[model samples]
Target: MHQQAKLFSLTDKHEQDAILQALSHFVSLRSLADENFECTWHDTFDWRLFAAKQQLTSRPHHQGYVATLIEKGKKVEQASVSGIFPSFANRLPAVSLAEKVQKHTKNRALLPMLTLEGTVRRWEIVDESGQPALELQVLQLTAESARTEQHTSLNTLLQLLPLKKRSNDFSQNFFTIVNGLQSTKSLPVDGLFATGAAATGLVPGDYQPWQPSGLDPQVPATKAIKDMIDHCLSVMQRNQQGIEEMLDVEFLHDYRIALRRIRALMKNFAPWFGSGGQKLEGELQWLGRRTGLVRDMDVFLEKLDILQATLPKELQEKLMPVKVHLWQRRDRGYAMLRRLFSSHRYRNLTAILTDCRLPEQREGDAEPVSIGQAATDTIDTAWQRLRKKGRRLSSRSADRDIHALRIAVKKYRYLVEHLRNLFPREFANLKRFKKIQNSLGRFNDASVQAQALEEMTRRLARSNDPSLLGTFQAIGYIQASLHQQQDEYRQQFFQQWKQLAQHMKRA
Candidate 1:
């Protein structure tokens, strides 16, 4: 058996030193153990991955080719008849499996290289694109022969990769990051939710899918939706003063996120509100679209510098005033947003969110499970599944596993937060999980951002202000700070996971 975790970050030429330093720290930490570690760098058009694999020398390198040749999107499963099939006769089988099993599956064009959640897995590509794109996934696995951290520690560290999006723009794809850990058997929702939560910060939206419709009074999820709406309303009531102090743009964005979650919950589950739900969802949609002006301006400003850099020297000089004009327009839009939020119509909308209620569907015959327990079970089960597949996972397999685990942890976190009192024991652990998840997420975001920044730098090399160089410098500084923080948090999260496991054991 093997146990593993992963860390993701964006590529930056300026922050190259900092990133390498962080990787050095990770390597040093792993070096304390007797197991020899393998470090490799994978670069592609879309992403760059610096991976650390444990006990790679013990395993045989992959040699046999498996192809699910696709002609115009239709899969052809004949291995011998495939023109693209690589010669397997001269190469050795990289795996050791039951002889009977291997013999039975030999004729199958792509034999199962591994299995994850009963899904047959192989390293061969299902299809190929004309573009030069590569997706690299890494799993930090510890074999049975090597000394490894406990499962809790491993998971805590795993959580870091998804959250690193907060501090930087590089590693923003929470879904992709989670998918990379397919071997870890993480909860199905862990990766999905992690991605969603990360997206909420940048985009401020709802939890896309709202399942288990029509309501079951005894279902914890049904109650969770109700409780969450109530909590959002209560939060608004109590924090309205503080909320008013922040930029209306940010407050409204946050409010919209909560409202959408509420709307999605009601829409997904029971029609307890019947006509009222349609009304509420309509209002929520109105709020979301209205707030779009603010968010759009913000996103635009964030990219303005990049756009400026991409212009020609003459165009750059001419665009300086245009930039100021756009900035003024954005500022006016923000002011309008402030007034809109303060209006009677907006207040009424918010008031509805606070006052909305979910009546018990069947007179509440049985008690629903606490939100915390549901989160725990889901996350734990997902992690277990990811761990079981760790040893034999390929790049694609690891991506799917990690993504599923991230989703599991994310949904669980949302639930635990919804009913904090129900699972007091796990409350602290959930907090730790959130922290680590955010760390890894930022790292990944930074990776992508770095790529964007590099492209922009080239495009802007001949442009004005030379002060834009300061922007790149700022980017580098943020990149370094995020890298340092992520490295420390990864270590800390691993430790927290051990404590969380103990708490779970006692429970």
Candidate 2:
């Protein structure tokens, strides 16, 4: 790769020429185009990776705040793969595409691009061993035209590629790196994030790092199996309503994820169970697919919403009646999902999972396989299926297949977490799957919300519920805004998918 923009000395503690000296090592700044743009690139991947300095600062009614800054850039392309960053250190904040945009807003030259911002979230995960990890979640929430002045203009040509595969490249590469760096270590309290947690002296248990230890063969298979079963049963029994809520809201999209991961562990690590493993594995997959129905429709509705939002306001208003009718139908779909899940068969499935039997071990066959090995195999299998499904869906342009692909990615991710002991390398790969999953997921959300809005509008036009009309108008704006994001990301998504396909082939 050609070297382009140089990394700069982000801290004044270094000196005036410090930025130049620091960046000069990794990049050559003395290139071209010194006139208009602050930075020029000879290479497509122009990102410079850096860890943030820990700074202590005063806050309201508090002594300090811990803050750390990661990668920073100039004139960066909005949706280009150049902006993607791997997961941050155990405790530090990770950078994402949207967060990168926000970081540059303080620069006057980059202000225009910043104003075109989208969604942003900070994700944190802690493991059993007291290790904490941080990840930044980003979504392109801005309008398409907002990016017109940028060096890259892929946003306008979104319709050129099939919608399903956009952003696959970024997702694939991201996961590859994440998996390599996967660790059960807890993030330290040394960075900018530590001050707040330290100030209260109330270290949150969830923020603790994960440390993997303790594997004993003397432990009985029944005991191990019971623990797994109890955990799932507890979740279902305690948060049974929450699980139902997820299904009702099509959150089964995620629940199926949780279910599938557990299933993979139970099936692949057969020694963990002594006998009856195959039967249980088959049943869990069935349940996963059963819940998948709600997930599929949810995605379908979201896509429909995106298509509808592209219409003129007048056309949208005219379609309001039809929108309401569709929602009632969607409700029926949800009802059907609930009925299936509530069946005796489904209950029996969970019961069996609770008491699953692993394959019997032969003489001298002590440990089946390490958790890390198991994780790698499980995720590898999942990734293969996702890619296959993604390809098939892309070729056929089938919405259901697209949804299935998302479901597969999610399930694989859950397995990645469950089997972290078996395979640390798969985390990065899981991250890649998540990126595309999220992109498609956002589209799915917009689609569902749009369907709801359209239906509400139709009902108001016919029955004239003032309250309903007000709700419809409110929802219409929300859906319209979501549509804007969907449209902007659509083009960027395809370019990413193309990249991912190429990368996967190379790998």
lDDT of 2 at 481: 76
lDDT (tens digit, per residue) of candidate 1 on 1-507: 111123332222244234334433322211111222221111111111101110001111234223222222222231322232222211223232212222332211121111111111111111122221122232232212101111110121122222222323222332343434323233322232222223233111222222222333345554666666775555444334323443223344445545545554454343456667787778777866766555555544555566556554444554454346447766776667668768998899877766666654424436445434444554455445433443333333433343344434454555444445554655556766676456434434333344444555565565766756655554444445445654564455445445655655576
Question: TM-score for model 1?
Answer: 0.33
- Candidate 2 residue 111 Cα shift, in angstroms, is 40
TM-score, one value per model:
0.33, 0.41
> Which regions of candidate 1 are displaced past 4 Å?
1-228, 237-359, 362-410, 444-507
Maximum-lDDT candidate: 2
lDDT of model 2, residue 192: 19
Give candidate 1's root-mean-square deviation (CA, Å). 26.9
lDDT by residue for model 2 (332-449), tens: 7667766866899888876666555554442355655433344445566666776776666443354455556656666666655554544555555556656776777776565555
Candidate maximizing TM-score: 2
